[model samples]
Target: MRGLLPQLVMRVLAAGLLTVVVAAGWVLWDTARAARRDAQTTAALVSDAIAARPSFEGLAFGGVAPTPVFRDWQQFPAWSLIAPGICVELGPRDQPIQRRCGPYLAAATPPDWFVWLANRLGLVPEPVAVPVRTRYVSDAYVTAIADPGVIVTRAWARTGDLMRVAVGMAIGGAVLTGLLMIRLLAPFGLLLRGIEHLQRGDFTGRLPRLRVAEFDRLSSAVNDTAAALQEAQAARAELTRRLFSVQENERRALARELHDEFGQCLTATRAMAAAIAQSGESTAQDGARIAEISGQMMDSLRAELARLRPPDLDDLGLRPALERMVANWRARMPSVRFELGLAGPIDAVPDDLALSLYRIAQECVTNAIRHGTPTHIALHIEVGDAITLTAADDGSPRHGGTIDSGYGLLGIRERVDALGGSFVLAPVENGMRAVARLPL
Candidate 1:
């Protein structure tokens, strides 16, 4: 859990960067294409402007041109314009016969656009083109071509320069976008820290209110959950303290009951038997009667042990425990009737929960007998992911005041609550019903 946050953050950042890169790359590609098209258009326009001028025809002839046309052309510095170069006029046999005004050619292979335009314009053997640098110029120079071809070749160079600019902007944009994302995501760090503190059993921290509405709601929800958990933990601790106290008292009570009741009775009975055997006056009938009484006393002691220890709870299980409890109740009040709906051999409940269930039933029965004075009682035990024990008595309520609860009900409630269960008592027709639901 401690390492979960860093791992989540890394995953989010990796995904974000990947998405941004893919999207930005696509956008940049489209921008490059659009820039190339615009460059081509500008290049054609500039070439046409130069070629349409009367001064350019004389300039092309080397017909004593003024310095201004050359100066003006040089001053037009733009990505679209193709640089000046030489051309050629063709003779009847389609051979280059004269040089035309243009810049010196420099390219290992003529640009494809240049060759296409020259052929389409019927300017065979006379090539017009944009010069590209090479180790050595091509032997096929001074040929016919047109201005558009030059512009097309220059469009590539201009597009190359625009690509560099686009790349710089894209990088800067990606960095800025990353930073903004980090800022937006920073509050989640606070939320995660709060959760970590809660996980470590520190539920006292107050979450900071967030500017984002959803985050604010989340912070509030977490604080509420923490508060509830803290309260529950405190209640559990208190219950445990009380339970241990009760267990210690019960242990002492059991020890005292054994020593004072069973132990003293056995010792007196042993002395009486010894005297009867030693005395000549003692009759055989008297000895038999004493032996019978001693046997009964031993049986009683064994029964008490069985009641206290409850070995059958582990062996015969919850069904027997509950049956024995009901039998004991019947013995105490023979006239009182009970209808039990025991869901037997219930899917093996946790040992602690089974004990709690048995104890809660005992408490309800005892309460019904002592307070409700009910002639009839109903008991039901249900089992599943949780266990529910319910007991109801149909009898008149005590008229004077609310019945005060003794250790019986308190002990049952403590046990149920210790295991994170709920206990409720409600009026059921003419009597009261006690219900306990414990998580298995």
Candidate 2:
């Protein structure tokens, strides 16, 4: 698509051209009208002058006479050389018309094309016939005609200077406007390039200060945005590294626990079975001890599985899983009061949205308890046009500002980002609040 500069320039040129056309047309029209009037007046006066002649009065009573032509009107140029083309025709009513015109004076002839247009448009006046009258029966007729060439020639003479000025002014305005537009839009290219860099994920791109105040502010904003994005990218990179480390450590712990606790428990059960088989009987005390080992193993497996993907989530869906999680946390932190609020159709959320919301809430709660040591923590989940999950705690204030990025907070952000949701972890009311919203 064409930009504003070219469009504005074209409009400006078009307006100037239109103005010139209108002004030139008005000037030509006025001159042509005046020229036609002068031709008509000259014809009338010549007819009057011819009727009073003694030669015509001495003619026969039947008014049968030769044509008398007068051509002196050409000697005196009337309004804009109009009289030059005037002609006087006088003759008996039944005879051929007489042509009596003067030497048609012309300083310059108008172009054939202009004369053709004037004639085609019928702007040139037709020859007018005026009857000669006397005391006796009058048979003389004087006709006046103005040449189309004369009318066009006169019109051009009157309008040429103004048209030239209009053309010059138009050219000057276009040039000045183009130059000014070019200067005004110079910064647009730089801004476009900087924005392209951002689109390409090259946050390192920066724009320079511009002379125009509005463009300068935009340049500064671009520079600031690039800096902010660069910083966020670096933080995310660090977060990835730390998160990977945390995952590896957790996996190692799980492996160690499996080897130490599970191996021992299975080994002891094997030994007990061997002894019981040898003894050919099952003792109550031995059965109780075996049951205790089985309980410990089950507990250990549940804990490891919870660290990965909670079994409750897959089996019971989102709401129940969240309820179980809260129950577990409440059992673990009996002194810390917890509130869980669920609204709207929580079950209608899709798998990805549910997972992300659950993770965000889980992370926020863990962070509040682990870092902030809050006495009261609240978690609320709402599902409508969008799925919203908010977790807040009455803990020590990190201040009512953006949360400092940590491994847990990053994990929460990652999940929400994957689900195309916005996440904010900020301080509120002497506590921390983490909110996430995902579109349904």
Error of 1 at 320 (Å): 0.7
For each candidate, give its TM-score against the true structure.
Answer: 0.42, 0.48
Q: Write the per-residue lDDT of candidate 1 for residues 1-440, one digit (tens) a residue.
A: 54544555555556655655565445444533443444344344444444443134445667674322322433444333433432223222255443333342332344576446435533322233322122222222222343434433443344444555655565565566656667777788989998998997777787989998998999999999889888987788677747755774585479558858877888688668757756756474586578678878777775675555454566788788778778877887899998778774563876655665766787788778887678899999988667878888887644322344435667666666677678877776788878898876
Tens-digit lDDT string for candidate 2 (317-350):
8889899889999999999999999999877777
Counted clashes in each candidate structure: 12, 6
Q: What is the lDDT of candidate 2?
A: 0.72
lDDT of 2 at 207: 95
Name the runs in model 1 displaced over 4 angstroms. 1-307, 398-406
- Per-residue lDDT, model 2, residue 144, is 64
**C-alpha local distance difference test of each model:** 0.61, 0.72
